[model samples]
Target: MEPESYYFLEHRQDLWTFIRRNPEWYRYLTRDTERINEIDQLAKQYFGKTIPQRLEKAQHNIQLVRMLIDMAGAFRD
Candidate 1:
Protein backbone atom coordinates (compact mmCIF):
# COMPACT_ATOMS: atom_id res chain seq x y z
CA MET A 1 0.00 0.00 0.00
CA GLU A 2 1.15 3.53 -0.70
CA PRO A 3 2.18 5.81 2.12
CA GLU A 4 -0.59 8.20 0.97
CA SER A 5 -3.11 5.39 1.38
CA TYR A 6 -1.81 4.86 4.87
CA TYR A 7 -2.76 8.46 5.59
CA PHE A 8 -6.38 7.43 5.21
CA LEU A 9 -6.04 4.51 7.59
CA GLU A 10 -4.00 6.32 10.20
CA HIS A 11 -5.03 9.98 9.99
CA ARG A 12 -8.60 9.88 8.73
CA GLN A 13 -10.38 6.87 10.12
CA ASP A 14 -13.72 8.26 9.00
CA LEU A 15 -12.54 8.42 5.41
CA TRP A 16 -11.03 4.95 5.78
CA THR A 17 -14.43 3.59 6.78
CA PHE A 18 -16.09 5.39 3.90
CA ILE A 19 -13.66 3.90 1.41
CA ARG A 20 -13.93 0.44 2.92
CA ARG A 21 -17.69 0.49 2.58
CA ASN A 22 -17.44 1.77 -1.01
CA PRO A 23 -15.69 -0.49 -3.47
CA GLU A 24 -15.58 2.12 -6.23
CA TRP A 25 -13.78 4.65 -4.07
CA TYR A 26 -11.57 1.99 -2.53
CA ARG A 27 -10.36 0.96 -5.96
CA TYR A 28 -9.92 4.52 -7.11
CA LEU A 29 -7.94 5.52 -4.05
CA THR A 30 -5.68 2.52 -4.08
CA ARG A 31 -5.05 2.69 -7.80
CA ASP A 32 -4.57 6.44 -8.09
CA THR A 33 -2.31 7.04 -5.17
CA GLU A 34 -1.17 10.29 -6.81
CA ARG A 35 -4.63 11.68 -6.32
CA ILE A 36 -4.40 11.20 -2.60
CA ASN A 37 -4.13 14.94 -2.14
CA GLU A 38 -7.64 15.25 -3.52
CA ILE A 39 -9.04 12.53 -1.32
CA ASP A 40 -10.45 14.91 1.24
CA GLN A 41 -12.34 16.91 -1.38
CA LEU A 42 -13.44 13.80 -3.20
CA ALA A 43 -14.71 12.22 -0.02
CA LYS A 44 -16.63 15.35 0.82
CA GLN A 45 -18.24 15.29 -2.62
CA TYR A 46 -19.07 11.59 -2.53
CA PHE A 47 -20.37 11.67 1.02
CA GLY A 48 -22.40 14.86 0.67
CA LYS A 49 -20.42 16.59 3.39
CA THR A 50 -21.13 20.06 1.97
CA ILE A 51 -22.99 22.73 3.87
CA PRO A 52 -26.09 22.58 1.68
CA GLN A 53 -26.42 18.86 2.13
CA ARG A 54 -26.11 19.23 5.88
CA LEU A 55 -28.69 22.01 5.98
CA GLU A 56 -31.08 19.96 3.91
CA LYS A 57 -30.68 16.98 6.22
CA ALA A 58 -31.25 19.15 9.27
CA GLN A 59 -34.37 20.67 7.73
CA HIS A 60 -35.73 17.23 6.86
CA ASN A 61 -35.17 16.00 10.41
CA ILE A 62 -36.86 19.07 11.86
CA GLN A 63 -39.84 18.58 9.60
CA LEU A 64 -40.15 14.95 10.62
CA VAL A 65 -40.04 15.89 14.29
CA ARG A 66 -42.70 18.57 13.78
CA MET A 67 -44.93 16.10 12.00
CA LEU A 68 -44.53 13.56 14.80
CA ILE A 69 -45.39 16.14 17.43
CA ASP A 70 -48.44 17.27 15.47
CA MET A 71 -49.62 13.69 15.12
CA ALA A 72 -49.26 13.13 18.84
CA GLY A 73 -51.21 16.32 19.60
CA ALA A 74 -54.02 15.21 17.30
CA PHE A 75 -54.33 11.92 19.19
CA ARG A 76 -54.67 13.64 22.60
CA ASP A 77 -58.15 13.85 24.18
Candidate 2:
Protein backbone atom coordinates (compact mmCIF):
# COMPACT_ATOMS: atom_id res chain seq x y z
CA MET A 1 0.00 0.00 0.00
CA GLU A 2 1.07 3.61 -0.50
CA PRO A 3 0.80 6.63 1.78
CA GLU A 4 -2.26 8.88 1.53
CA SER A 5 -2.10 12.60 0.82
CA TYR A 6 -4.28 15.47 2.04
CA TYR A 7 -4.69 16.77 -1.51
CA PHE A 8 -8.43 16.39 -1.83
CA LEU A 9 -8.91 20.11 -2.48
CA GLU A 10 -12.64 20.27 -1.73
CA HIS A 11 -12.22 18.53 1.59
CA ARG A 12 -8.82 19.93 2.59
CA GLN A 13 -10.11 23.15 4.11
CA ASP A 14 -13.07 21.46 5.77
CA LEU A 15 -10.79 18.82 7.24
CA TRP A 16 -8.33 21.39 8.51
CA THR A 17 -11.09 23.53 10.01
CA PHE A 18 -12.72 20.54 11.69
CA ILE A 19 -9.41 19.39 13.13
CA ARG A 20 -8.37 22.85 14.26
CA ARG A 21 -11.69 23.49 15.93
CA ASN A 22 -11.77 20.17 17.82
CA PRO A 23 -8.58 20.03 19.81
CA GLU A 24 -10.46 18.39 22.68
CA TRP A 25 -11.64 15.59 20.42
CA TYR A 26 -8.02 15.04 19.50
CA ARG A 27 -7.15 15.03 23.19
CA TYR A 28 -9.82 12.49 23.92
CA LEU A 29 -8.63 10.39 21.01
CA THR A 30 -5.17 10.43 22.52
CA ARG A 31 -6.57 9.41 25.90
CA ASP A 32 -6.98 5.68 26.45
CA THR A 33 -10.59 4.64 26.43
CA GLU A 34 -9.26 2.14 28.93
CA ARG A 35 -10.04 4.91 31.35
CA ILE A 36 -13.61 3.76 31.02
CA ASN A 37 -12.40 0.27 31.70
CA GLU A 38 -10.68 1.51 34.83
CA ILE A 39 -13.86 3.15 35.92
CA ASP A 40 -15.65 -0.09 35.22
CA GLN A 41 -13.20 -2.00 37.36
CA LEU A 42 -13.66 0.45 40.19
CA ALA A 43 -17.40 0.14 40.01
CA LYS A 44 -17.13 -3.62 40.11
CA GLN A 45 -14.72 -3.57 43.02
CA TYR A 46 -16.75 -1.14 45.09
CA PHE A 47 -20.20 -2.40 44.21
CA GLY A 48 -21.49 -4.80 41.57
CA LYS A 49 -22.59 -2.56 38.75
CA THR A 50 -21.05 -0.69 35.85
CA ILE A 51 -22.13 2.63 37.24
CA PRO A 52 -22.81 4.23 40.58
CA GLN A 53 -26.19 3.34 41.95
CA ARG A 54 -26.80 6.73 43.48
CA LEU A 55 -26.08 8.43 40.17
CA GLU A 56 -27.39 5.93 37.64
CA LYS A 57 -30.12 4.22 39.67
CA ALA A 58 -31.36 7.61 40.71
CA GLN A 59 -31.25 10.78 38.64
CA HIS A 60 -28.80 10.89 35.77
CA ASN A 61 -25.57 12.75 36.27
CA ILE A 62 -26.49 15.37 33.75
CA GLN A 63 -23.46 17.60 33.80
CA LEU A 64 -22.11 20.48 31.76
CA VAL A 65 -19.55 18.44 29.85
CA ARG A 66 -22.09 16.03 28.36
CA MET A 67 -24.57 18.82 27.68
CA LEU A 68 -21.95 20.87 25.86
CA ILE A 69 -20.85 17.89 23.80
CA ASP A 70 -24.40 17.11 22.73
CA MET A 71 -25.15 20.76 21.95
CA ALA A 72 -22.01 21.10 19.84
CA GLY A 73 -22.80 17.93 17.91
CA ALA A 74 -26.35 19.15 17.32
CA PHE A 75 -25.07 22.42 15.95
CA ARG A 76 -22.59 20.63 13.72
CA ASP A 77 -25.35 18.57 12.18
Leading candidate by lDDT: 1
Q: What's model 2's lDDT at 36?
A: 34
Q: What is the C-alpha lDDT of each candidate?
A: 0.76, 0.45
Per-residue lDDT tens digits for candidate 1, residues 1-77, read 57757755678876776677765766776677766667667677778897888999999999999999999999994
Candidate 1 Cα errors over 4 Å, as ranges? 1-5, 21-34
The 10 consecutive residues of candidate 1 with the worst lDDT sum are 1-10
Clash pairs, candidate 1, are none
Candidate 2 lDDT over residue span 1-77, tens digit each = 01122232124454334435644433432454333334334435445344556566544446666788999999999
Query: Model 1 reaches what TM-score against the true structure?
Result: 0.62
Which pairs of residues collide in model 2? none
Per TM-score, the best of the predicted structures is: 1
Q: Local error of candidate 2 at 53, Å?
A: 41
Alpha-carbon TM-score of each model against the true structure? 0.62, 0.21
